[model samples]
Target chain A: MRVQFVLQEIWIGLRRNLTMSISLVITVAIAMALFGTGLLINKQVSNSTNYWYDKIEVSIFMCTKTSSNTSCNKADATQEQKNTIKSDLEKLPQVSAVEYESKDAAFARFKDQFSSTPGMVQSTKAGDIPDSFRVRLKNPEEYKSVSSAMLGRPGVDQVVNEQEILKKFFRILNGLQWAALLIAGIQVIAAVLIVGNTIRLSAFNRRRETGIMRLVGSSNMYIQLPFILEGAIAGLVGGILAAFLLVLSKIFLIDRLQGSLQFASQLSWSSVVGIIIFSVCVGVLLCALASFLTLRRYLKI
Target chain B: MIHFDNVTKVYPSQNRPALQHVNVAVEKGEFVFLVGPSGSGKSTFLRLVLKEERPSQGHVHVAGKDLSRLNNWKVPHLRRRIGCVFQDFRLLPNKNVFENVAFALEVIGKPRRFIGKVVPEVIDLVGLEGKAHRMPDELSGGEQQRVAIARAFVNRPMILLADEPTGNIDPATSIGIMKVLDRINRTGTTVVMATHDAAIVDAFRKRVVELEDGRVVRDQSRGVYGQAY
Candidate 1:
């Protein structure tokens, strides 16, 4: 009837079943933590994909004096030929930016990019580098058009899109994401059943009280609300614990694990906050559902 | 007030009916006793009046509501008018005597102000004024039953159905419980108590209804327990 009356009953019932309540809270927290981790990783993968995808460019390497391509001749490209190629690429509607790199400039860029991998840089000679045009497209999907146009040119050796490599990386991350989601789903279901059964036992133990309440003209809502609130209280506690665990994981696990992987440093603060809120909401909703279903059969009030 | 018209209850797996074509009536403010040996349908009769079990055939009307026609949602409202005291003294063990008494009012949404006044008054009526704060486990069998009686009467129900209210207590304690019931009945509340205690039955000598093998064999005014046979 009154909110205070219902709350009082909930408090008393929860106190009587302290062990069951604690178990429910722990189970919910663990399950929500696993679920939260999976979601966070999925979010990180998407964020990183967007970050890298936007920066990806198509590289067209031109044949030179020592190149193996048959289209290349002994003489290198003249300044007019280089200007013509850059002008043609820039004229295309899809081409946003086209920058040419000379053999020496390309080599220097390669050394800068692979500065940490000195062994890789030393194994290759400077003349082995080819002059190339780095073509940035307005849309990454136009990479195919740019590649087709530049592939058969007189001085072209090959046209390579770095987005293909990123695609392969994303495929593997996606697989791991699904695997984590499946495991998280199973744990959530198991947690729900555990909470449901615990509430069932509490309902069974207090069946006489429920029966008396029914006899004394208590409404179905009045009779059931206390048990529902009990489950929700357990869920609330679990949610708090889950938020704590997620925050701890972000601070300790993600932050520390980033030291081993350079890109993981990009995991954002918003992602951590999102995981905490999402985990707590899931915990509360699942526990409420479990309590509702479990009480339906037992409480007949 | 209560009325039964040819009510029959056949429990699952039992060849004979628990109650067979039984008919009885009790008007407002009347005190009646249902006396029978164990397994004679005394409990079943009480349960039927409360709609705990619907009659297999015929109608059970209590407090002007036809229980056979009543919806599930309406059953609680029906029960609100009829208070029940069980033989086991079904008190919530965790609750103190005062809480146990207050629970009845709480369930019906009585405001705390009303509960504060009515609970102590009912506790005093049951001679439990000093033990209001004692838990059920802390009380003796007689005191526990008294607490149960207090809970039953606190709501001022229109009809009280007490099933063996004094069965577990000694004769002296049984007398104390009988006096409490009498006091409640004096306030114009109908009391239907089912008991097998013949000594108390003879001493009270109120209207008695006797049941045997799912049938009413005797109904008399100021009757002894076994005078019919």
Candidate 2:
């Protein structure tokens, strides 16, 4: 109940175990930093998924003069075949939009994509790429409906779902996010153990004081208050350090991710700020809870 | 203000009961000495009154409340009314004598102004008047015990329990410690002390309750410490 006394006790305990407290602070900082990074990665993956899913297209290539498929019959797809294909795709409910790309337009796109490579642009011929229907589905995952229907169709050379390739990239990012989270989880456990050890040592050091306090009619809450505050203060310092680490990670890790993967949108500063707040709170609560549990087991008042 | 009705105490780890079928009572404002051999449950008697240890079989009552039924949360409140002194004089090594005594009142939420007024009075009562600022390590064994007594008595509790209050001090200093306890007892607080000092026990001529192997073997007024068996 005495603020001055409790504060004094906390200061004494922290000072006595200065090395241990410093280690505890560092452990908590690293754990919270990793946790924040994991959360940012989660946000990055989801943001990219949302951004790229909208642009995903399923391409249905039509037969060319040199098409090898038995259904192509060694002849280019006629205007009638193209019209029937376009009309059938439009009729399907899964299809949101269908745009026909002529062989000349496909060639132009290939040249534009490989503009930096002069040799690749010069070697590609217009007719080499067959005409195709770029089908945008209402749901990217619903590419299966269109692909299953168009496969082996007369005049169709191949049906390629763009989502499949994108899925592999997202899967790798998801794995990375999970790895960050897993390491963060382990670090959190380590932080908890350190917090527990720190509190136990503090309690042991102050056992005489606690004993005197107990005999003098101090409640269990009163006896445990200083120890609990010591843990919380250490957590608070660690959380602040972790906030700095999170800022560095946002600038170095997430920013670099956005730079290399330009197709995915960058994680906004507001979301990073939100994750920082959440991770700091988690750090404080985790240390406080660990200290409380450790006292319950070891310090009997 | 304390009563034990056929109390039996058996710790979980030990097969033998520390105190068996013990019945004793001390009236309010009484100074009683619990004299016995080392393992004869003298310490257990003081602990039971303080509610530090519960009786296994029979009921232990202090200030008219049965301790067996009292809630664990209420134990601190009970302890507030019972001052305890140990042989080792358990003082906060980091705090001075004044802060040590004030700690007792501070823990119980006493006001700063009130502690400022009362801590000096209690310190002076235990004859540590101007030595308030001295730390525990600086004080002698007798002065440290007096400081522990000051801390215990700062709240003006209804009962005082001293477990070997002079066990660590010399014969001359032990007399001074006993005098302080006697003065506190004169203030109408019930004092129950457990001791092994037969000379002081015989000199005091107070109510003596002797225990041998956890049973009350003698209970008499103005009694002396009997011969050791």
Candidate 3:
């Protein structure tokens, strides 16, 4: 009720529990940093996946002279078979566009793809290349249906999508993001519990003082206000420290990664800023709630 | 100002009731001594008036309001009208005597200017005028008790409850504490004090209420501390 006295008591309580307060700050800071990082990385991963999905093409390889699959054993795909396949693909509602790649075009693409390695180009010949149909689907997720439909068709060697190749890479990014988030979850819980324990200890230590106040007609909120403020201040400090760490990582780690990864899309500042604000709010609010509940349970007025 | 109608108290951990069939009343501006031995419900009597403990049966009333019917949130308001002191002289080790006394008015949302004016008056009333800046640890046991009394009386309550106010102090300092309590009583505030100090009880020669096994065995005006042990 007395604002000045309550503020003074908060300062005193924080000072007296200096060690515990410091530890609580550090714990909340570390947890918030990890939480922000996890959020940012998740955004990055999702952005990367969506970008790659648009570029994904369902490649339908045609039979060639060296092809060994039963579907391709008879001979190179005849002109009628190739025409039939093209018409079939166009008829499917899921197919957006289709491009035909002849053997000569495949050989040219192979050479250009291996231009950096002269030996790779030297080892390949025109007849060694396979003709294919590059099919773009209206929805990338429908690639599964296209792949299955073309699997055993006449003169078809294989049906493959680019997403399958990038699966290994996306798996790693998602795994890292999940691991970071899981650890952050655990750390946040620990931070809340640490705040709770610190409040309980301070309450126990100051029982004598509070008992006197209770007798002197102080309300429960009046007695608990100082401790709640202490927890909130510590949480705010932790949030600030975490925001600092997140900005540092963005400059030193993420920006540099984007420099070499020009093909990949980067997350916007709003997302990082959003995460910073969210973590800070969560830190302060959660700690205050924990401290308040702890006082209600243990620091009876 | 205070009344107990056949009040009985039973703690969950103890089989027997602390106070049984207790009926007592004290008028406004009266100084009453509650004399009893160990485990004879002195503390319980004070606690009931403060609403710290609810009676298991019967009713306790203070300021014409039945405590059993009082809302939990209204307890603080009720206590604001009553002052309480204890034997341990529970003082905040971090605060000085002045701050401790001012704490009472501060919690009840008094303005700063008013607290500034009233803190010194109560400190002087408790006879600790110059020692206002002394921390609890800096004061003697008696002076600490004086600070507790100053804190309790700073709000100028209608009633004052002292549970063993002199239990932890020596006979000489205990007299000083008694004199301060008596002085506060003379200022038109009803005073209810529980004590085992037979000397102070007999010397003060006020209304004496003796309890034995949770029942009032003797109550008389201008009475001495009768040898009932």
Give the clash total for candidate 1: 0
RMSD to native for every prediction? 3.6, 3.3, 3.9
What is the iRMSD of the candidate numbered 1? 1.6
Q: Per-residue CA lDDT of candidate 3, range A108-153, in tens? A: 9889767778998998889788899999989988998888888888
C-alpha TM-score for every candidate: 0.87, 0.89, 0.86
* DockQ-based class of model 2: medium
Docking class for model 3 is medium
Instruction: Choose 1 or 3, whichever is better by lDDT.
Output: 3
Best-to-worst order by TM-score is 2, 1, 3
lDDT of 3 at B63: 91
TM-score of chain A of 3: 0.74
Model 2: per-residue Cα lDDT over A1-301, one tens digit each? 4888889889999999999999999999999999999899999888988888889999999999887888898899889989999999999999999999999999988887788789988987889889999999998888898999999888899999988888888898889889989999999999999999999999999888888888988999999989998999999999999999999999998898776656568789999999999999999999999999999998987
**Candidate 1 CAPRI assessment class:** medium
lDDT of 1 by residue, A22-135 (tens): 888888888787778778768767887878778879998877777777777665656676677788899999999998888899999889878889999999788678898999
Return the lDDT, model 1, position A214.
79
The C-alpha stretches of model 2 lying farther than 4 A from their native spots are A61-94, A100-133, A138-142, A148-158, B227-229
